[model samples]
Structures are given as structure tokens and as C-alpha cells.
Target: MTIHSSHPFLPPPEDRDPVRRLRGRLPAPVSVWTSSNGPIRGGWTISSMLVADGDPGELVALVNEDADWWDLFRKTRLACVNVLASRQSRVSEVFARVAPSPGGPFRTGEWVDSAYGPRLADAAAWVGVRLVDADPEHSGWGLLVRARIESVDLAEGRIALQHLGGHYS
Candidate 1:
């Protein structure tokens, strides 16, 4: 009676996981995860994030452990998820370390300080969050960070960037 049982080509229930092959099949929005604490500024391109359901609402980001943002995230315990506009693919590429931008990634995009952290000036939207927990050994991919949303800034942008099949869509 369920689609899962009817689809023979689908992965078995237990085998269904966030494996790269599976994730690659799903489209995820591109975002630049940024954080700062007066002195240090760090950011990286991320596609694994979501606004989770809860009181006060929450944002969860799965950050690679080797990313520079990891330490800044810990130091600040705060961050801003800047949802990229479709035209900002270059900015995403710079942060993803895929392309060279003059003066580096920070210089590739306009940035401004917000109450929670630094946010992209031209982002489609931005969500500020304060770290509630960080699980380092989660899913063998990266740190699982759950944060409480503190602020949100929605701007005017129609086209949003998405990542799928190893490319931006």
C-alpha cells in the first residue's frame, strides 16, 4: 500500500541512508555558512542545512570538520546561513574553493556584520543562529550543529541556487 514497498528499484529501508549517491539525487539549496567573533571570520559553502521544527525554531548545519568555519563556529557559537541567489553562483564557487576570487572568498562577496554574525550582503535571505550543540562524530561526514534561530533577514530575490548531481542547478 506504500510507495516504498511498491518500488522495486528503491533502496531497502535499512539501506536508505544519506550516502553521497542518494544525496546527489536530491536537490539542496546552496548556502554560505559564516561566523565571526570580532576578530576571526570564517565561512564555507554548504548544502546540508535545514530549518528544523521547534519552539524558537532551529537551524541545523552539517559542517565538514576540516572547514575553517568549524573553529570560528566554536569560538563564536553563532553563525549566519546566507541562502545564495541564483546569480551568486560565483560567490558559492569561491567559498567552495572551486574558483579563485580576487582577495579570496571573503572578497568575492559583500559582507556585513549582523547581531548574530557576518552575513552576505546580497543573499536571498539570512538566518542567524546560536549554537546549541555540536556532535563531532556524527554520520562520519562532519560536525552536526543544531542551533537556535535568533534572527532572520529576508531580502528580495526570486531565483535561488541549488546543488544537485554534483553541480549547481
Candidate 2:
């Protein structure tokens, strides 16, 4: 006797975080935050960020507290925020650890070393910053990163990559 259920075996979908799902709907820049601590180099893909205008200006971002990149960033307290181009989604995915980058993400991208850190050679724009560690609070799962914008570089007519709804927009 041969018997088989009409539906294929499958597990029910897991409950998704409403906050994360909702946040995903909002468009954000595809930025890579990079830092160099001595000989160690680290980078992380970050879209949870904001820019505040002031005398010195400020850029605040939420960073994964547990990420190795965060540890490296904390050491130097300085980093470069590089906004990727619209055509550089693969670079973002690589830095995000969502794609397989055999030699590492930096290996595939052109980079220029600066006072803050390594900045993407062809980024749409870049911001150099020094971390403000006044508050040690965690926002949800990320550590609240407040930075003083040290420098800014803008490239005209370049489209920046935007992420929304779990995909690039």
C-alpha cells in the first residue's frame, strides 16, 4: 500500500518580530561603517542611522552590540560612514554578511585610507566621525552610537542605494 499526504512536509512559519518587519518597510541608506584598530580592520552594514545638524553636526546609529566590528569600532572610537552606490548592492550584502564574499568584503571593493578609517573608494558619500560614549545604553539589541561628524564628502549626481521591505529599493 502506498499512501502520501497531498501537501508536502513543511514546518509552520515562525513568528516574525513586528518591530523589525515594520522597520524594514521604511527606506534607509545602505551605509557601511568602517574602522581600523591598529592592524585590525572592521566594517558593518548599517541602515539604522540618523543625521542631526548642529554646530559640529552629529550622526547617530544603532550598531549590533555583539558584532566583532562594533568591538573594533569601540577601540578606536573613530570610523568612516560610506554610503554605497545604487549599483553596489552586492557590496552591501557582503558587508552585511548576507552574501558569500570569499576574500572578505573589503577585498572586493576599492578603498581609500583616511584619518577616520578605510572609506569606499567609489562611495556616493562619506562621513568621518568620532564616537561619543557618554551614554552606555542599548536601544533594543543594538548599542546606541552617537558620533560627532568630523568630516563630510559629497559626490554630485550619484544615486545612493536604499533599502526597504527586506530588499533594495
Candidate 3:
């Protein structure tokens, strides 16, 4: 499949750049994509997470073609997207680390296995999703997964987090 980029000079329908068009109209929510199992058989993390649909609890996330968590996700077919609170920037930093490994974030941290999946002990809230389908085109990304939410846990706190642009406030 061809993912097009939006052209600024053209009209809405004429715009070919999907990311640019999307950026102009939508504000993406930040989420840490996570999975389980590695050399130590623990958890993992990814940076791309998006809600695919509302009904039937659907969501979409992109995993890099070469990431370790991609393999785990392929096997388990399950994952958790942890939504961090404002005070949880440290958690994001931990997950965002490029060294060590993808599971680096959970190296020394605590987590709980939930009906949805594994959730960070400190996350404000989290949703569990079971892989329904995956489409990996030519983007070199592992695959774009459409998942069904299995369950949700909403913890107490004001939601605030940062993404590609900056902090969400």
C-alpha cells in the first residue's frame, strides 16, 4: 500500500502527504507502545500509538521493522499502550532510550500483568489490545496493527505528556 504525504499548496483532497495533512488537522495523543518477552522475558516499548477506532475497541500502532518488540508483538499478538501523566515524563524518557535495548524502560521498574496485558505500575491509565490484523507495506516499519481493546484501567490523575512536537499542556 502507498502512504501518501500531503502537499501544502494543494487542496485537501489533492494533498498527498498523509502525515503533513494529519498534522495540520489532528492533535495526536502520546502513548508508549509496550509488549513482553525478550532475552530475559520481560516487557518492551514503542513510540507509535494511535486509536484506530472507538467501536469494538480498536487502535493502530506502528512498530519499526527492526525493533525487538516487533517480534514479541508478532508472537504474543498482544500489547499495552500506556498513557503517561504529566508527572511521568521520567517514564517516557526511560522508554524513549535508544541504548541498551527496547526493553530498557522496564529494566528495573515495576509492572503488573492485567486482563488487557502488562501495565506499568506507575502509569496513570492503560488499555490492553489484542492484535486483530497487521499490514506491513514498504515503509520498512514492522507492521501497522489494528487491535481490539481487551480491557482498560484508568488510574487517578490529570493526563499530561509530550510527543514529537513538545509537552502536552
Per lDDT, the best of the predicted structures is 2
TM-score ranking of the models? 2, 1, 3
Report the C-alpha lDDT of model 3 over 43-88, residue by residue, as the tens digit: 4444456665677868766666666566666677778878776666
lDDT, candidate 1, 1-169, per-residue tens = 5455455777766776667678889999999988887766788898888888778899777778888778888777888889998788898988888899787678887888876677887778898888886545575577777889888778874567898877776
Pairs that clash in candidate 1: none
Candidate 3: where is the Cα deviation over 4 Å? 1-27, 37-47, 99-103, 138-142, 164-169
lDDT of 1 at 68: 76
Worst 10 residues of 1 by lDDT: 1-10
What TM-score goes with each of the models?
0.82, 0.87, 0.66
In candidate 2, residue 61 scores what lDDT? 89
How are the candidates ranked when ordered by lDDT, highest leading? Answer: 2, 1, 3
What's the lDDT for all of these models? 0.81, 0.86, 0.62
The Cα error of candidate 1 at residue 106, in Å, is: 0.9
Better of 1 and 2 by lDDT: 2
Misplaced by over 4 Å in model 1 are 1-18, 134-136
